[model samples]
Target: MRKLLFFVIIFGFSSSIQAQKYSKEVLDSMYSITQQTKLELTKPKSIKLMAVGDIMMGTNFPNDSYLPPEGKGPFDNVNVILTQADILFGNLEGTLTDEGENAKRCSDPSKCYSFRSPESYGKYLEETGFDVMSIANNHIGDFGAIGIKNTSKTLEKHNIAYAGIFAQPSTIFEKNGITYGFCAFAPNKDCIKIHNLTNAKKIVEELKQKADIVIVSFHGGAEGLKHTHVTRKTERFYGEDRGNVYKFAHTMIDAGADVIIGHGPHVSRAFEVYKNKFIAYSLGNFCTYSRFNLDGIKGYAPIAEIEIDLDGNFMKGKLHSAKQIDEVYPFIDEKKRALKEIKKLTQEDFPESKLIFDEDGSFTQQKE
Candidate 1:
């Protein structure tokens, strides 16, 4: 009888310890220690995530001629690179509604752009291997609530997750035994506000508790050709507050975000490493078509591929240089324009950062 009782006691203790292994405090401590040590454990399980900036993929709301050729042919050049990643993300800069009056009123209808792609375009996103998209841009609500609802349904039908909308500000999914969470923010109607740091931190913290890895995407910063650098201060465009992207990224990192992706500047900015977390200030225009100016700096952007360990520690990244040719399709640039520009921007904007980018587009952190 005593032997059986001892065996029961041992089993109970072992189970209790196993249960406590994943408690909040324990996990926090483990992550902190791993980050501090900066240990590159041998053969640790990791996930590769690829992200890009604003993508319109051609719009055919008021006109059908703007749509790309019937099928997945539009993504022929970049689909392979996109599909290779475990998770592919991008910013969907327009609504996917077939019929809705545009809510945005521009002084000059000719210059003020509003994109409304047909619902069928969602299939293109799915075929291109876009797992998640951020609907937190200025153009998402071009057709108001109906536009938002239809866009959500279209993305759902295609089995693509989206964040930054009214109903779904964050999403969680599991891949290869790892749980990943994504949330997006923007200073636009019907989207999570990027300027609200308190709310942003709260949302990110809640997501961090629910998933092993958390990625935050924000659409902030001023726009156009001159707004290419990270000023590290609140930026304004046409007297509108665009939020301080630098402060926002650092705060999100401190709040347990594993990766921070920024866009909306329409130009690529610098990269930074904070607390062993990776942050790309702005990815610029990825695959915009028509209604967008693709001149000089605005045309160059990077297809950022980042790898992180199971614990969400920064590992390495590669920037695939791409450019929007003829203001339409995005093609791989042989000149490595985006990579070289990012390297220069990173050095200029974040001179003290520990992250380093090589000529071949590969990136690593400075060893302690």
Candidate 2:
């Protein structure tokens, strides 16, 4: 009798049909409800994810002079926009340690650039709503193993997730009932190499099996204004292979990556839509305090807000323009320089791409 009652309840049958006998109307209603439930479960849901380029609030390694006066105030201007997204991401340009041995050997101490931000500054990232960060850039290893360890611990203490180093190649976390898998790669030591497509594909494939969406971040490409465009081939900086970003992005998408965010280059590159996924080749320098070159396009700080479905397909996006002048902080760019730069680069690099950028920085994929 208990089993019969369970069957009736499972089928959504009336109490009178407890005997497992149902009228045509009852059966039809049950089928309709089942189909509706399936449709609801299979429906695509989207989440807004905001991404930016290299972010180093201040470096105390050389001296405190490089530190910003406002400290956390550097992010105040864009906090409102950043908090609006479900996930906020940026590339941690340097270690969050107060002191550490300089990893790179430089004969001229004055010419050396080693960034070591205070550990307390991690709170600024948490308060600014940064859900995740990519610590797979060239500067991440500036202070060596100690720098890497301290930065990881600080981010963990602040409840922020980070990846790219070999110790923690990828991370899976949950937000609002959706699971996201994130992994980062770089061409630097102690970091996951972006050049190894075999390993990258394996990591992404495994992430796709366990997570609802997969996000891949790579700190590749040559640096500076002269290397702003995607060459669709391997890039080398000072004899280091930066990996072929064009090939890497597409290969990751094929491996089930939903979104790809690229950095390392200190200037925004291009945007492309392939296999229903969104890829930003480079976001440039978002918030770098003293010691960085803030001239011409190098100063442009663009915030890319991408809306993607549960399947990780691109829905729409927008680019918010911001720039750092002589100050260490970034302010809203009234001239929309970031938007203009990305538009020009994307057009020149990926003319066949389906992405359409408007004058106001709003973008969407062209319908098939």
Candidate 3:
């Protein structure tokens, strides 16, 4: 009876959705009126959205500046970077709390990288102006269901908003006059296994109607490979079942997603203009400890800032490229050269793609 009831509940929720079909003119007009957020109908005044790749706070590569030395890590540097944005975002790639004994990180502490950062890190995340953290990565459930539960608890305890880890509503967040959503999928069954699609689609479709802007984050695709590349067909990491990123992202956009930021391919993928919506294939590793298997171009990461006008519409943004050169004990530092290199690489990844360059490691779209 319990199992039957569960299926009924899922069906009930899935059947209830009224997705809005938007025309280009209406959307453009909406954006124009809310260009800088002057619309009273649906305006957020000012919305600054920032995103990075993976923040695998692994204990294996313990460092002082980047992560906490020991008990209760301090998120000072992360806060410093995030403070600048009104709504900061990133993929927290691990469980925050120290709970559960069922799924241990790995047998070998060293070389075993199931990130378990101090739950106290949420304080700095909140204090740093981070409005939301996407738990949709391959490590959100690293320690199993217990890890997901603990991570959610710790983030909430510190007043940090998170999504894409909980069952259904657990991964959905609507705030700041914008209905934001995230869903983390994986191809690996060992670490952070994901087995839900109805829940993911339901969340996206629902959020599209209720929120002014719907930002969907996906975490999948092959890792450490140059431009891992997204095929329209289902992707397999090592014959596992990494959903087709192209399909996943485009499907979400078609369902009224304003923006789609994906990260899982630890190396960046090409940014494409699909159906008039922007899709960042993969942002790569944001704050990682190991550079193993990382080649010349795969290690570069960028701090992407997407600015939505007052009406929650996509306007423009700057890509601030950065690097994590030192494998262990590294600090989040911006490399001017790395930014240029990444820009050039991005252009190459999508030969048909356009790119704009700037001095001091920043780039705006020439034709976004």
Candidate 4:
């Protein structure tokens, strides 16, 4: 009888430990230690994610951001930080294929915007560590469906995957051998060309079934300014109002999305933890060289990294921000010390940000 009681006690203790393992607080604490972030990843462990927002490679493209025979872009400057993650992501704010019907160019340079990039250069995205890109943005239809088709084709040709819009396959996060499904919604209306209402719900539901975790991206909200804070109310664009981003993002979360990454407001917004998930309201511009936006305080882009368990529940996360310095027509900036400085300001912007400033004013990712 004593032997059986001992066995029961052991089993009960093991079950308790495992149950405590997944509590939201404990998982978040463990993720703080994984920011050194590596690929090939650890098993039954958390996965590190890196993301850039609004990759607007326009007429002012930088050499580092674009590959040869593609364009001159500075995307390579952040390659180290970006490539070190398990899978990297970004918002492809411009179409990648040249075959699409060109968007009607806005005449006002101050308000002008239309985006395209050569398809051949997609190899750079693969080489530079971008495993997935989101196509649900205003520019997805800039070249029309032909352009969207060409962009999807080029991404597939390069073996670089995408999600959110076009004829793209649902992307996933593969960590600890678990596949996580990805989907997105854009107010751009073009998302319907690829993901209709029925299909969008279907994909989200399917992701819940097939993925260890599900991440949803959405491009909805008014453009420009730090006033992009999302509420539980509808928003307007070009005089047409749309669903509340807060409601939409959380709705998808309830429907099985483990995380939510939102963009399109050319400015960054405060993030929150909802339903045991992390939601970055916006990350703004990462490698974009647009001479147009004068965000001033809001244009600085965040290099967001999140850690999640095999089932894609939020563990912990951090943001490494970078600023777009010049406002020139052809814009580009070296990211050498900029990363350090940008991180400093981010700590100011987000009091809860992991970065800590020393008494002497230096910043480090970990407080220890």
Candidate 5:
């Protein structure tokens, strides 16, 4: 009986030890999971994105006269405003190739303009806080495949992400633990066509699956000051179909795009908030140097600084106005002409919008 009792006690003790071990393991696992959850909750959830339009600092195609001076940087005047954002974006209006044949056939040589910035000029964009560039514009193919290849190589070397051509339709990148997907569209050859909504939707939907936020850039609309307004209908510029920007923006948002930025008009346009997403119809001429026609409204360089949640909901935004004068680089406009133009255009185009604008250049969506 004593032996039996001793055996029973030993068995009970072993069973208790096993139970404790299992419980301890479960508790440890639960604790680890809880800690991981806490970390996730503490991770950064907001991103500041800054965007500008049409950045052709200078081109050496025709001659060296169109290029900026040796010691002076193109963005030196507005570097402070640009360097403040987490992601700085712009449309690269030209190629970054030193030597390539100009493929554009000009009926009138004087009317034809081909831009080919030197390869060294890419560093200036990088230094000026340009994180990504849209190589999906009319001028991207001026120098043919070699220009595209050289531009890609230079951007890669500078760690500046770029997309929009047939070869590189979209790009995925990470910043501050948030994954971002970016794609660009244009009506020009060799670029991802802006008129193809089906393809655009497919690209954006695929990006939404993998990225925390998706940004879509379209180079559409008619060019020059007369075409500054969003007409809501399909626009044709110089016999080319510039997609209906209104339809495109709404469609992209429906297809999981969080932000829509439009350019190619070479002038600022209205701002819109659709389904809680932000859209900038056009950002205007940002840093086009000598060869550009920076006359009056064409010189308005508005820097759009936007804040969005990790899910890419529009939070707030600010428009910093800069203007190009004397056919030189852009300088901060104390008159706030660009902001005023945006405000006026937004009011005229989207009067029913729920966005609240302040005199200080800040704007936000009205809380329902």
Candidate 6:
């Protein structure tokens, strides 16, 4: 009975929508309207968004051993769920530079982890259904400015929208009839600073004015298995300030961000629904091959699928549990470890929050 119910929910929610394309005149007219008028005039439609954590699909710059086979094996296990969404997003943990001088200095090579994937890997991301990627993480500058430029160029060549690099701090794109604005922030150098609350809020507000839905991604917070729970305060790691992720997320939501996705902590954290917006504290290491530590909790993550109304209000979501085994490709976890862990963390951290998750991984808000 329980299994049947789960399938029913999945099938019922997996809607196939064909967005009506508007002419340039219609789009311009829509943009010119006031917020209240726009909301009243817009037709409500369900928009599905899939978000995952850090993705460093095997880097071969330092060595060839880390590279995967010459095929689409990296995302084969998870591509089904990925392609189902209208928009798919994830944090690009490292640069996609084939050749460049590494900029990061490490005292101990054994402990340091820097990634640089081949430029050809950008197509693989597109094939795996990644429409937009966040390039604002500590390792994004592993190969310096050259790497950053190459990463942006490569993604653009593959028709993927990217943000949080160079002067392109935010990207606004339209799919179907819904306009989405995406921006990324991190505490690392050469990206939008997550610590600057005033600046962050201002950017989100500006994005809100242009797009119907604004989604913000941040790579901040302490890392490792020990950092599974959100402290709701400022966090620091290795003498570097990781920013107050709680305040940052809430502020972004208040500034008109419909969704907030966080990743940096290599472990999964809690989920919260603030002011009808959904926020995932940390989605953990979605797919970090070779160099990443994948022991215990570090390997657990969820391919989060979220559905929101045209007005950017949270509707429902599901967590498809996945885990990396032996630092290789990610596979669905039979035990649903990621889902269970998030449930526990959400209960402990936001006890009074309206978001409710069932054992089957489907989530909804409590009735008023």
TM-score of 2: 0.87
Cα lDDT tens digits for candidate 3, 121-214: 6665566566667786666655678777878888878766666643634345566545555444444453223335555577677776666667
RMSD to the true structure for each prediction, in A, is 7.9, 6.5, 14.2, 12.4, 4.2, 15.5
Once fitted onto the true fold, the runs of candidate 2 whose alpha carbons sit more than 4 angstroms away are 1-44, 70-72
Pairs of colliding residues, candidate 6: none
What is the C-alpha local distance difference test score of each model?
Answer: 0.87, 0.90, 0.62, 0.65, 0.91, 0.87
The most accurate candidate by TM-score is 5
Residue 327 displacement (Å), model 3 = 6.1
TM-score, each model?
A: 0.86, 0.87, 0.73, 0.71, 0.89, 0.87
Candidate 5: clashing pairs of residues:
none
Best by lDDT: 5
Runs with alpha carbons beyond 4 Å of true place in candidate 5: 1-42, 107-110
Compose the digit string of candidate 5's lDDT tens values, residues 1-368. Answer: 99999999999999999999999999999999998888688667788999999989888766777787889898888999999999999999999998798888988644679999999988898898788889999999989999999999999989998999989999998776678899999988889999999999999999999998899999999999799899999999888899999999999999999999999999999999998899999998998987788888999999999999888999999999999975588889999999999999998998767677788899988776
Model 6 stretches with alpha carbons more than 4 Å out: 1-44, 107-111
lDDT of 1 at 325: 68
Candidate 2 positional error at 203, Å: 0.7
Candidate 4 lDDT for residue 359: 34
For 285-344, candidate 6 gives per-residue lDDT tens digits of: 988888887888888968888999887888999999998976578888889999999989
Clash list (residue pairs), candidate 3? 37-310, 164-171
Regions of candidate 1 where Cα sits further than 4 Å from its true position: 1-44, 69-72
What is the clash count for each candidate, in the order shown? 0, 0, 2, 12, 0, 0
> Which residue pairs in candidate 2 have backbone atoms (N, alpha carbon, C) closer than 3 angstroms, thus clashing?
none
